[model samples]
Target: MLVQKNVPLQGLNSFHIVARAQALAHITSEADVKSLLADPAWASEPKFVLGGGSNIVLTGDVKPLVLKVEVLGRQVVGETAKAVIVEAGAGEDWHAFVAWTLAQGLPGLENMALIPGTVGAAPVQNIGAYGVELQDRFESLDAIDLQTGETFTLNAGQCAFGYRDSVFKHSSSGKQDGGYSPIGLKDRALILRVRFALPKPWKPVLGYADIDKKMAEHCTDQPTAQQLFDWVCEVRHAKLPDPAVIGNAGSFFKNPTVSPEQCTDIIGRDPKVVYYPLPDGSFKLAAGWLIDACGWRGKSVGMAGVYEKQALVLVNRGSVDGPDGATGGEVMTLAKAIQTSVYERFGILLEPEPVVV
Candidate 1:
């Protein structure tokens, strides 16, 4: 329950933005949250739960009591006819968790390998890659109600998952389904751990051109889960700048989903628009394509730049170890500029993926 004051956050966030938490506390268990809430000085304070810091943008020093989730563990917990249940601490590295699952002969999560962030942060956005999403394998999660300190568990149905979104992303104010039935969690819940139902008879998810190229290179139509994992990691590395070398928060914007008529209109605007049809009949336009079409690739607004290889990723062009690196303001400036350019050209406003704090 020790709350440290003025903690530097440069080493914590993947973006490597220089910022500090006014006061920070680490929680390793449910009891930590309960204890913090029981304290008169901090019980009534607003709080922010921090994890791997791979999916956040810190505009400035954090003012709320930052709860650094450090809870840790992972194991195969149970089995059923259709799947094997696995449990992981919310604080576990998401990529590490995926690798561990594979080491245990679990294969369903391979397509989502190398995604940056913690397991707890995964559901907040229903993280997906190649052809798989977290919701596809999610089972249940244990969390604490920050408002009342009540421990509760939510199954996938109760989670109300959708493309890159979940209950944790919204507030308690009458937010509708797609995220939750009627109540949204947003700053009101703190996840402790999560459970996943890895498919029993694991099947590979493929068909993306990047993956197809990998398959072609290997000269195999039927690829193993490990192969899929390695390909995903390779593709990501080739297209993205590692945060260890360059400051960035993966894909900066979400691929916008558009109606059929809208897609047709965009196609008329540019016949070569990269898009994929969803099972629901809607079309998802590539945000990267839109940005690249706007001629933003390798462009910079101050110290923040659009990744040359992938227009969807805005990067910090400044020295990683220097204080003159891209500020949060500069990153947002570039992101907003990209958003505006895309909207003007295609009538689709690209939504940013990171949680701007």
Candidate 2:
């Protein structure tokens, strides 16, 4: 375990928010975790697990001891006639791992190409893109209990994945009256590794508008995994701002899901509202479309601003190389303002996607 104090977290997070972790520990192995637990000075202290720093906003200095997961490895652990089971350490770069799977001829993750963050964070957020979600490819995951220092594994059903959410995003004593028992692992579990089951009989996930446009421009109906991967990357580059260049978390809000009645009402009010019907008959409304409809694009709140090209993304307009940057408060204030406007117009609340620290 490599321990450090008063570490600057400005560059660690994709948003480039200026902040600090009072105490940060680099855990490269399970042994590192065990060592930290055994130490009297650190054991029993409040803890926080940090992954690629892509899907988080630091509102201020982190008070908990930050465990920066850095364990790294990737390999095909097993294979059957139908699919290949690949395992990767939690700290592996998600996009790089997707590319590696393609290099090895695994095709299931192509639709999610170019997503930022570490593999461990994928399951927690149930990250998705195009038409595929992490839950669709997840096999199992290994994690450690922060409070007990115990290790365990969980399968897909145990993760309770929903749109942009997972058990890992909730607290332990979650609501129990929603026709099922609530199981939230939020702030109590540190994911150590993840496994993916890539099917042998690979089929391309198409029909997304942007993907359809790509196919039309390319003049091809059948796209290979590599082609799909490349297309997704290209489309994302043209749409979403590169975090390295602009300092923003990918998508700022979850596409709100509504019933057909609600959809019809919204459509009646604004026929141009971008939406998609889900397999379950619910309608997914485009958050960016709502924000843009409310005239929030290119708007700013102090150092935080909405991206001019894509209203779905909130960006840091302040300096990336220094202490002067968008405070988490500014970003949240802007986000709340956008939310209020969209709600006032569309009668639906927009849920933020990033974890607020």
Candidate 3:
């Protein structure tokens, strides 16, 4: 394990915003994490865990020890007639893991082909793309409780996953009290590894509207797992900006779910409004459509602008000097504007998916 002080976090995050970490450590093993927590230098210091740093916006410098989980490995732990249980280290790149699963002929994760982040952070947000979510294949995960320096396992049910949220994000308080609070500087835990049960016979899903249309146009009657993966990658690449060139964190907000009555009311007013009926009987409205209808796409406030192709994504096109040059605040302002506009137009509220820190 290597510990560095005053590390620059500009390149660590996908937003490409500059921030400084008071102390940073790369933990290769659980023992290193335990030892670091026991050190007096970090006894009272706040702790933060980082994976790929894909789904976060750093408002300013972090005053805690940012422990980067570097543990790596993947193994087939269990198998059944219907599914195969695959376990991966938390530090494994999320897209790499998806590709590895596709190589092994696993069926479930093909729809989430090119998502950015680490395997560990996948369950943290119950990440979903196209028509699939992590909870669809999640079995369990292991995480270290920073408070007690103890390792704990969380099953799918224990994860408390909602739309882009989980226990690792919603649990814990700054001080020890029975009050609900956001996981902030004083209360955060580290994800260690995740276990996923992928289907064996590979039942490919072409559920999302865009995916279905693309497959239909390509004459794909029954697409294979590899075909689905390839198509998803192509679609995402065509629509979303490559964070490597343009700074972004994928979709900035989640599609707001509304009741059936609310959906009917909204559709009654505007017949062209697009919405998908979820399996749970809720209606998932098109957040991008709402934002685009409000004339936000390609609109820039200062350094941040909505991606012209995908209204859900906010890009940082400002100077790359430092915090002053970053457009984190500009993105938030646009997001808030979209949220307020959607609410005023349709009485539906849009919620941001990324962790705004």
**Model 1 segments more than 4 A misplaced:** 173-182
Clashing pairs in 1: none
Q: Distance from true position, residue 16, model 1, in Å?
A: 0.9
Residue by residue across 1-357, what tens digits does model 2's lDDT show?
Answer: 568999999989999999999999998888888899989888899999999899999999999999999989999999988889999999999999999999998899999999999999999999999999999999999988776677877889989999999999998733344422338888888899999999979999898999898899989999999999999999999999988888899899999999999999999989999999999999999999999999999999999999999999999997776777899999999999999999898899999999999
- Relative to the unseen true structure, what is the Cα RMSD of model 2? 2.8
lDDT of residue 155 for candidate 3: 81
lDDT of 1 by residue, 49-168 (tens): 999898899899999999999999998899999999999999999999999998988899999999999999999889999889999999999988887887878898778898899988
Q: Candidate 3 — which pairs collide?
A: none
Give candidate 2 misplaced runs (Cα > 4 Å). Answer: 173-182
Please identify which of the two predictions, 2 or 3, would achieve the higher lDDT against the true structure.
Answer: 2
Best by lDDT: 2
